[model samples]
Target: MSPFQPWAHGLNEIRFQGGAEGFSREALSELLENVPLAIAVTLGPQQIFAFANRLFRSAMGMADEDLIGRTVSDVMGDRYTPEIRALRQRVFETGEPQELKDASLMLTPGTTTYWDIKLLPVRGGEDQISGILALAANVTERVRARSEADLQAREAALHNERLALAVEATELGLWEWNARTGEIFWSERQKEIFGLPKNEPATYEFWLSAIHPEDRERVVGGVGALSDPRSGGGLHAEHRVVHRNGDVRWIVSRGRMLYEVVDGELRPSRLLGTIIDITDRRRDEEVRQLLVQELNHRVKNLFAMTSGMVALTARTAETPKQMAAALRGRIEALARAHELIRPAITGSEPSDGETSVAGIVEAILAPHVNQGSPSQMTFEGPSLRIGPKAATILTLVLHELATNASKYGALSVPDGHLRITWIKGAMLTLLWQEEKGPTISGPPKAEGFGSQLARRSVTDQLGGAIAYDWRPEGLQVRIDLPLSQLNA
Candidate 1:
């Protein structure tokens, strides 16, 4: 027989008769003792315990003490507030059922439990309510599980919010696509990256169209591979985009595809990614590459010029000492010119810390200008930013001219003045004139190595023209150079 069989039989008999009045107290007590629920009966306004089953006594922490005639508050302690007493009184007077769901119950000082409680009014033979019957079921585990889930949801929300703030601070553009709905979502920065207006709706077609024609095929193929299960890792692509404003910019994109099983086959369900503008970095890289090539070309030219100078000096010198002196002077002149070009080529700053035409001229003539009063040499022109290659060629040409004037022209004698001036328009025109210097009978019959090199640099390398006029008082040289070549 089941352990509850005897109690079940008596309880069934009392319930069959529809009331507890006819049953013996011993029979009723035995029936309630073996029941699963926490059951109790309280009488009068003080809610004095008339009967408490084994489960009820255990829940109230009064299993070893007498519970009969004890008030509900006196047994359950302070956690049972006045509101509970009022609720019991109302239930008894109205002869109605009342309930509390997931209510906290503290049976000990430091321990708490939850329960769902129902209070039904028990009546006497006259049908007048005499007591309240309480039934309780523990719900502590269920309430704790729900509270834990709520906490996790809040933490996840906070984490996502922080991640979004970090992404915005870094200026990254975010995008998401849903394959099932064919819908796309773009953050504001994403739209700005593509140069799209706020009102414009972003679509997959528009994205593909924005990519430069040369890179569209490759980018599309990479993105398409995200759907293939065989392909591992996320999508990473660096390509060029033609903005709505017709400006081409470089961008890098990284993303992963989300997949779900459909009909036993894994298929892509969503795509999410971020984009970063890399136009400035790409341009800097290109400039560095151009600088390397220009440096190599300039080194080769320097060697060729040095070889020619050696051969020419050997022919003219009557002695080895004279040849060495000429070659040393020429090499020193080249070194002075290179001092101006070094900053630009090596990515350092010159003394004046400038990379313009005026900066270059001021640096090269600093030595000569310090020797005489400022009035002896004057410069007049607007400053233009020139690249390393332009600065190198211009430095060599100017250095050669200055050396020639110091040796044989205006700078050779005191009281001789040299003025340099330039004007910019369709092209750059410069004048190097000397006054009050040794009279010039005529131009040299044969072109020297310095003159040949200077002419070649101005015309061939700089795509400019040079002319020398042997005036009676002094020599005047005119040079006209293209603006494009100078900037390059």
Candidate 2:
């Protein structure tokens, strides 16, 4: 017989008129023992077991096959049998049926089993309660599977929560792209990366515009190539982007194509990626490059300066002592000028550690100023920052001018004076006026090294204009520099 056969087998033992399926009493009892469901018939108030199925004997963990007259407490232990007996007694008293679904049963110590239980009260010839029939269906596996599924769902939720928190802490900007529709979604952090204002709409053109000019075309083409299925369905790139305020930054982008079966065919629909700010790293790389360029230029300049000093000393020195002193002074001048070249600080705030333009001017002129009147050459200017590149060239130009003045110009006389003034607007303008000193007969016809250095400092280093006017009173110099190059 099937394990779940609905009909009870050979149930002809009970007395009834016109019983259709008559069989020997012993034969009926044997068939009842072989039935599928856990069934039992109990007799008397104690609910003694009058008959028990093989399944019921196994559930009770009883060794004896014949359980015809034993009390339930005798076979199933007193700890649990009392509750079963109480349930039977209630059914008998009320003449009602009982049913319990998904109820816990402890058939063995430290082990739990679930059951769907049913009980029906039976009566004697006097219509008084005499016996009871009970049935139980096992539901342990079903209940266990449901509990396991609930635990897995809770764990999955917790894992996603932790992943989101980590992404937030690291300031990773998230974005989702609809490949076929050309639609895009940018998270708040992603908008910040793009330098977009609040509530600004995002579009593919906007993304392209944010990329650096030199890198934009390549990036756009690569994105198109990503749509090809043979391209491994992923994108990884490092490129540059210009912020809305004109700041340049490096971007590391990664994304993958998403697909789902539609009509049993895989088709791409979405792309997702994350971004982070990498401007600082890009600046560090540029600083390393600038260092190499500066070293090469300075070394070449040192050789030229040494050769010029030798040539100039030969013309002015008459004795061994005079030549040595003159050469030493010239070399000292170069050494002092070198102090003005600050370390290269590249990137947006390149003037961060550099000194002010006025500060550099004062340092170069300190040796030429009269000790009693340190203000012999007065200086005036508003706050202005100068980068190392501009400061180096300006230092050389000012040192040359001061040296010339100390020998034949303003500082040569006790009453001589020079005034230096500058202003900052769209551009920087600096004027050097010499007065109360020897008159300039004429401007130099031939440009020498000092003149060449001064001119180059203005045009090459400062990216500005320089002019000289030799007046009857004294020589006047005016310099105009781009305000941006001063790192203001």
Candidate 3:
């Protein structure tokens, strides 16, 4: 009762009776017509179609008259290439069956379809091959689906390759954990990050031990949060690690926990992420904080000193112009001292953050010293280290003396000259003498702000004493300070 039941009888068992009721040509044709495949028969050397089934006619988009007596080229047009002809000829001459998979055909002018084609040789009663039988199945959909999947797979591979290059360029360490297998994978860079041996396997216990003792507890808590659903399965932490050799490093880790559905329930399956070394950045941050604190303390001291200078200058100046000129000169001197100190405080100094007494004296007086004349100033001293605080106060005291000399003392005339000398022992002794300038009668009646500030700084701040002798030609000043105060 099946459409193909006639085929159940072997070819040798079939006896042609020349009637529709027996196994005859008409009966065979009827059986081929209802089969699912596209079946056709071609005859003789011209390969003219001798028979065509319903599916064959539909697949070719032709009627019986258009195909029955026509050669393959007449019906297929340009679509029947020499390759197809050679395949059919091979089947006819060798009397062997041939198969072609995923062959393309043009059933319509502009449309294409693919097929799996099988061709068989057919013989006449004379026992010689006379025709070809073609069986085909449409496979366009399957072939296109396979092609699309291949394209997507290639694109995904390219994407992963680019991502790996980016990670390597940035020196990022990659890691992965498989919860079900109790195994972990570490990239070569990841091993470098933890200072692990090349051949040593990465383990959870080793990871925990590598963390600094002070940070291990916090890191463990962060891991716990990674697995907790409430935390959205993500983690970010900055911590320290201690190597086997006792070298400590800072690191920042960022990762996420992956989940999979098992029996319709989501469960943690792996942890994956990257870690990068942050030791340099951490050190920079610490240095920046120290600089900020140092700058703040210095600013407060400067403001307090300015307030005192203003209050004291007001009492000594006979006019507002005098006060303004004195305040400006004092502040400018302070600014110049700040410039010398900043290089050390900001870590840009060529040597250690320490300055000697000779260095400070030269730096403060360099602007006032005339470049064209060598006789204007002279200095003699041994190198004595001055602390940062003492350097600030000493520079201010020397600047006040120089400002007075430039305005009214030895430095006011071209012929005037100044000499400085210092010696270091249990105490430091320094002398400032000026000569060949405007003659002075005696000491001033009232102590000016500059003189007051210099005296207070020497006696109160620097643990020293200052005395001035207003000689006829110019002035002389001598200062003595304990060695403890000079280098403190």
Instruction: Output the lDDT of residue 101, model 2.
Output: 64
What is the TM-score of candidate 3? 0.64
Query: Tens-digit lDDT track for model 2 on 1-488?
Result: 12233323222335543356655556666786777667888877887888877878788877555576887777666445455666777887886777666677788888898776778766776666787777777778877887898899889899988978987898888889997788999988888888987599888889989999999888888777766666666888789889888988788888887776678876777889888888788887776776667767776877887887688667756987877865675566566545545434323333334477787778778777666654678899987877666776777777777777776788788778888889987888888888888888888777656677789878976789889888878778988989778752
Top-TM-score structure, candidate number: 1
Off by over 4 Å in 3: 1-27, 93-97, 123-128, 161-173, 187-192, 196-201, 243-247, 260-266, 301-333, 342-362, 367-372, 375-488
Clashing pairs in 1: none
Whichever of 1 and 3 has more lDDT, that candidate is: 3
Order of all candidates by lDDT, from best down to worst? 3, 1, 2
All candidates: TM-score: 0.78, 0.66, 0.64
Deviation of model 2 at 224, angstroms: 9.7
Clashing pairs in 3: none
For candidate 2, give the lDDT. 0.75
Better model by TM-score: candidate 2 vs candidate 3: 2
lDDT string for model 3 (1-488, tens) is 11122122222344657765576777878898988888888998899999889988998788988898999889888878787888999988898777777889888878888887878777776668888888887888888998999999999999989988999898899999887787999989888989998799999999999999999999999887765556788879899999999999999999999988889877778999999999999999997887788789889979988998899878878899998988888888898778756665666763434587787778777878777676588888987777655677778878988988888888889989989899987778889999998999999998877788778878887889899999998899998887888644
All candidates: CA RMSD in angstroms? 6.2, 6.7, 9.0
